[model samples]
Target: MSWRIGDYLDQSDLDVIVVGIDCNEGLKRLDEYGPWKSNEMSDVFSAERQSIGGEGKEYVEFIVHELKSMIDEMYRTLPGETSMAGSSMGGLISTYAACVHPHAFKRVASISSAYWFNQKEIEELIKESDLSNIERFYMDIGTKENTESMTILHT
Candidate 1:
């Protein structure tokens, strides 16, 4: 659910392995982790925004915890080296995961995140929390990002 993730990583010339996670249940996963469901930014993307993602933060956290532990055990990974990246709602959750579990994810990239889904709450969350262990963050959005959107992309 991204643009040339592998090719981009290869071009960067960084010796980092890419792990692509598919979001077949994209909206559901977003609601589980995104802590938002206003459906206010329905026009931001072309996908049918039938219903907003549900409030399922606990479920999302549990799943992420389990996945990280399993991946660590199953692979020869270095500590403080995990990263998560995605686009749209995928981007939103990557940011959330890093904020909530910084030790597990040292770097995060949120590409064109659908912050308009629940902008106020996320803004409050950012102000209210203290993030640690995160070494890098990358975020991007289009110049023409939904002029009608309340959470218009600034950059």
Candidate 2:
């Protein structure tokens, strides 16, 4: 999507820096050779299975603090200027990050998020969060996708 959005950004006069994170690094091949071989999806990204290995919290913390700090050191950034975007489970983590650190991530785009993975927890978190710091939040779901657990933000 980033590769295909240049024209749209130019037309909208949106100057932006896009950073792509490879969240699934080495997990695909790790399973073929070691005792650590396991289901990377559930281990790393699934909030519902967090007790086992849901490393999403660590991932989000790194993005919100470390990564943002590095970028801020290298460039000039204003308050509420950072944004996060992702699809599927990535979207889920992005949404989580926004809720957890709204001041750090002022804009979020969650496309087809896997809300069903931990619907109850996320819904509760959303209800408890203060999102006044967020500037823009874009959420979408495909017509063909299951809507059973899609987040229904009341604000």
Q: Kindly report which residue stretches of model 1 are placed more than 4 angstroms away from their true locations once superposed.
A: 8-13, 25-33, 39-51, 55-59, 146-155
State the lDDT of candidate 2 residue by residue for 90-144, as single tens digits.
Answer: 6777788888899898899989876655566678888999999999999999889
**What lDDT does each candidate get?**
0.68, 0.67
Count clashing pairs, candidate 2. Answer: 0
Best by TM-score: 1
Residue runs of model 2 more than 4 Å from their true location after superposition:
1-12, 25-53, 146-155
The stretch of ten residues in a row with the least summed lDDT in candidate 1 is: 146-155
Please list the Cα RMSD from the true structure of every candidate, rounded to 1 decimal place: 5.0, 8.1
Q: TM-scores for all candidates?
A: 0.72, 0.70
Ten-residue region with minimum lDDT total, candidate 2: 29-38
Q: TM-score of predicted model 2? A: 0.70
What is the Å distance of residue 131 in model 2 from its true position? 0.9
